[model samples]
Target: MRKRGVKSVLDVATGTGFHSVRLLEAGFDAVSADGSADMLAMAFENGMKNGDHILRVVQADWRWLNRDVHGEYDAIVCLGNSFTHLFSERDRRKALAEFYAMLKHDGILILDQRNYDAILDRGYSSKHTYYYCGEDVAVEPEYMDEGLCRMRYRFPDKSVYHLNMFPLRKDYTRRLMSDVGFQRIETYGDFQHTYREEQPDFFVHVAEKEYRMEDQEEGSYGGAVSTARSYYNSPDADAFYSSVWGGEDIHVGVYAHPAEPIADASRRTVERMASGLGLTEGSRVLDLGSGFGGSARYLAETFGCFVQALNLSEVENERHRQLNAKRGLTGRIEVVDGSFESVPFPDSSVDVVWSQDAFLHSGNRLRVLEEIRRVLRPGGRLVFTDPMAADGTDLSALQPILDRIHLDDMGSPGFYTRELIRLGFVPTEHEDSPGGFEDLRAQLVTHYGRVLEETERQEAEGLGAKVSSDYLTQMKKGLTHWVDGGEGRRLTWGIFRFTLSEG
Candidate 1:
C-alpha cells in the first residue's frame, strides 16, 4: 500500500474491525464501515481493545454507501470474502459502482473472494493456513453450485453457523471489476503472485481506477510499452545495461568484428542510420525510445542538431540528463519522459525522427509509425533499426522470447515496408532498392552472445552487484533464445531510413 502511494483507506467490510484497526495502526487514515450495526459496534469495541485506538465507524449499505459515508479515499478494501454476500448481480454492480464513486481519481479498490471454484469443481478442503486457522474448528461448504455456496462452520463448543454466498469465479470477478470501470485489475492467490488456480483459498484483487496505457486492447501494445518502461526503470536493469553496453549506448550493436567494443559497434550503427538523415545545425531531431541519450548526444556533437531524447524510463532519462550536462550537451539535448506510441510533441515538430532497435518493443507498430508520420515535417527523415522476426516466420516458435518481452508479435521487414509506405513515407537514399532495407537483415546472435560473455565476465569480477544471479540466468536464457532464433533465420535486425512524403 505504501509503495502504491496509499495514505488513506476505507475498510468497507471492516467485519470485526480487524482490518480497519490494522490500517490505523499502520499509520493510514482509515474509516471503518459495515452494513450491520452489530458488526460496527463490535468493531469499535475491538478497536478500543486493540490499542485504545478510535475507529471512525459508519453504518452504510454497499449499494448506497456514499449516502452515509462521505469523502473519497486513496483505497477501499472489501476483504474477508465479503463481496460474495451480495446474491444478485445487480447488487454487486451497484456496490462496485458506489465504491468507484467513493474513491479519488487514482484510488484503488482491494477486494477478496473465496476460491469458490475449487469448492464447486473439486471438493472443499483447507490447509488451515491462510484463513480460518482456528484449531478444534472446522469449516466446509455444506452445499455448492454455480449460483450458491452454503458454508458450515463448527466450533469447539459444538456450536454451528451457516452462511450462503454467491459463488464468484475468478475470471468472472475480474470481468465484473473491469465492467465497473476499473482500468486495471491484478489478482493474487493467497497474496502470492505465483500460485496454482485451485491452490489458493482466497483471491485478492487490486483494481486501479486510474487510466493507464496497458489497459488498452491486447493488440495496442500498451501492455508491452508499460512493461518496457518498468523493466528499464528497474535498478537492476539500469545497472546491468549501463555496465554491459557501456554507460551511454544500451541498444544492440552492429559489430564490424566479433571482438569490437559494444559501445563502438553500437555507435557505428547509430552513425550508419544518421548518415542518410542530412541533418544540419539546429535541425530538430526526436530520438524515440532513447535509452540513456547516447545517440542523442552523438547527433548533437557530430551534426550540431538539437535532439529531443524521448524515453519511457525516468531512471534512464535521469541518467541521460546527467550525461548531457556532463558533456556540455545539455543545451542541445532535451530529455523527455514519454512513450513513442503517444509522442508528447506537436505535429510536424521535428525535422527527423531517429530510433535504433527500439520499435520491436512496441505492441502496436502501426500506431508508432503513424505517430512518427504525424510528428515529422514533410520530407523529414525517419531512421530506425529494430530486431524483427523474419517474414512469414511462425510466431508460436518465438513464444519464449515473446513471453519475456510481454508482446504478442514482432514487426517483419515486409510489415515495416508496407506500413511506412501506407503512412506516407518514402524510402531515402539509404535504401538499397525501392523495397528499402530488405538486405539490412543483420544477425543479432553475435551481439547477444558477446553481451552474455561480457555480462558473465563482469559478474565474475564482482563488478555487478546490482545484477542478481537470477537476472543473469534469465538474461542468458533470453539471449540464447535470440541467438538460436537468429541462427535459424527466425529473427532479423538492421537499420531502416525513410523520408515523409513531401506531397
Candidate 2:
C-alpha cells in the first residue's frame, strides 16, 4: 500500500478489524466496512483494543456498498476470501461494480482468494503454512464440485465450522476483474512472485483502475505479444534484421523480380496495400504491429496521413521514433509501445488500419481483428498482409514452421474472409486480384530464398558477425521450413482489403 502511494484505505471485508487497526497503526486513514453488523461491531472493538484507534465502521452490503458507505478510497482491501461467498454471478458483478464506484480514479483493489483451482483439480492438499498456519488447527474440504467448495475448519477445541464458497478459479476471477473495468491486474501466489499454479494456497490480485501502457499484461490471447517483444528486442535479432531487412521494413515482400532487394520488394507491398485505401492528406491511419515504423513512415510521407504506429517491442519503437524524427515525420507518425490485441485508441477513430506479416504473431487473430474493427470508423479501410496457411492444408505438417514462431496455428484466407464479413467488413475491389479483391495469395518462397542468400553473403563479408552462429542456424532452418511450406502449397501470403460497413 505504501509503495502504491495509498494513504486512505477501505477495508471492505474487515472481518474483526484485523486489517483496519493494522492500517491505522501503520499511519493510514482506515475505514472498516462489512456486510455483517456483528463483524463491524467486533472489528470496532478489536480496533480500539489493538491500538486505541477508532475505526470508522460501516455496515453495508457489498452489492450496494455505496448506498450506505459514502466516499471514494485510494485503496479497497477485500481480503479473507470473503468475495467467494457471493454465489451468484450477478451478485459478484454488482459487488465488483460497487467497489469500482467507491474507488478513486487511480485507486487499487487488493483482493485475495483460496486456490480453488488446485483444490478442485487435484484433491485438497496444503502445508498449512501461509494463511492458516495455526499448528492446532486443520482445514480441509468437506465437499467440492465445479461451483461449490465447502470447507471444514477444526480448531484446537475440537469444534468444527464449515465455509461454503463459490470456488472461483484463478483465470475466471481475473476475467471478472477485467470485465469490471480494472485495467491492470497482477496476481501473486501465496504472496510470492515465483510459485507454480497448483502450489499456491491463495492468490492475491492487485487490480489497478488506471491503465498504464507499459504495464500491459501478455493477455489471455496466447502470450504472443510478450513472446514477440522479447524476441525482437534481443540484440541479435535487432542487428540481424537491421542488416538484412534494411532496418526500416522487416516484413515479407512482393518480389517484382526473383532477386529484388528485400527493402524494395517490401516497399512495393506497402504501396500495393495502400493503393486502394483512398488515403487523403491528414487522414488518420493505425499501423498495427508496426515494426520499425516502415509502413507508418511510408504512409505518412507519401499520403500526408497521420499514423499511429503500435508495436510491442521497445527496441523497435525506439528505433522507429528515431527514424520518424530523422525523417521529420515525428508529427505525422506517433510510435506507441503496445500490443495490437488491445489498441489504445477510441472506437471509430481511425480512417484506415494497416498491418503486414504481423497478425501471424497474434495468438488470438480474432481479437486483433475485433480491435481493428473497434478503432476503425464507419467506411474505414483495413488493408494489410500476413503469412498464412493454405486452405485445407494439414496444420500438423507445419509443425516445424509453427515451432519456429511458437504458434499452434496460422490464419488462412478462408478464416480472414469469414471473420471479416462477420465483423461487418465489406471486401473492396482490388485491380490486381482475380477473385474480386478476396484472393491475392502469393507464395513467399522466392522472398525467403532471396533473404537467406543475402544473409549468407552478408555473413561471408563479416557484416553479420554480430548475429550469433546459433541464431543464423535457427534462421536458416526456419526459413527453409517456410520455403518448403510455400513450395508444397501448405502456406499462403497476400494482401487483404476490407471496408467497415457503413450500415
Which candidate gets the maximum lDDT versus the true structure? 1
What is the C-alpha lDDT profile of model 2 across 1-503, one tens digit per residue?
89989998999999888888888999999888888889988988887788689889989999989998899999999998999999999999999989999999999999999978667655788866678848787888999998898999899888999989999977678779979988666667788643422367888988888654433455522366666666676555777888887569988888887888999988887887888678889699999889888889998989999999988877788889999999999889889888888898999999999898899988888989999999999999888888999999999999999988878899999899899999999887667753324343453888888788988888787643355455677898888888888888999888888889999
CA deviation > 4 Å runs, candidate 2: 1-216, 219-222, 434-443
Worst 10 contiguous positions by lDDT, candidate 1: 212-221
Over 256-370, each residue of candidate 1 has an lDDT whose tens digit, in order, gives 9888888888887777777756789969999998998889999999999999999988778988999999999988999988888888899999999999778888877888999
Candidate 1 local distance difference test against the native? 0.83
lDDT of 1 at 253: 83
TM-score for each model: 0.65, 0.58
What lDDT score goes with residue 485 in model 1? Answer: 89
Best by TM-score: 1
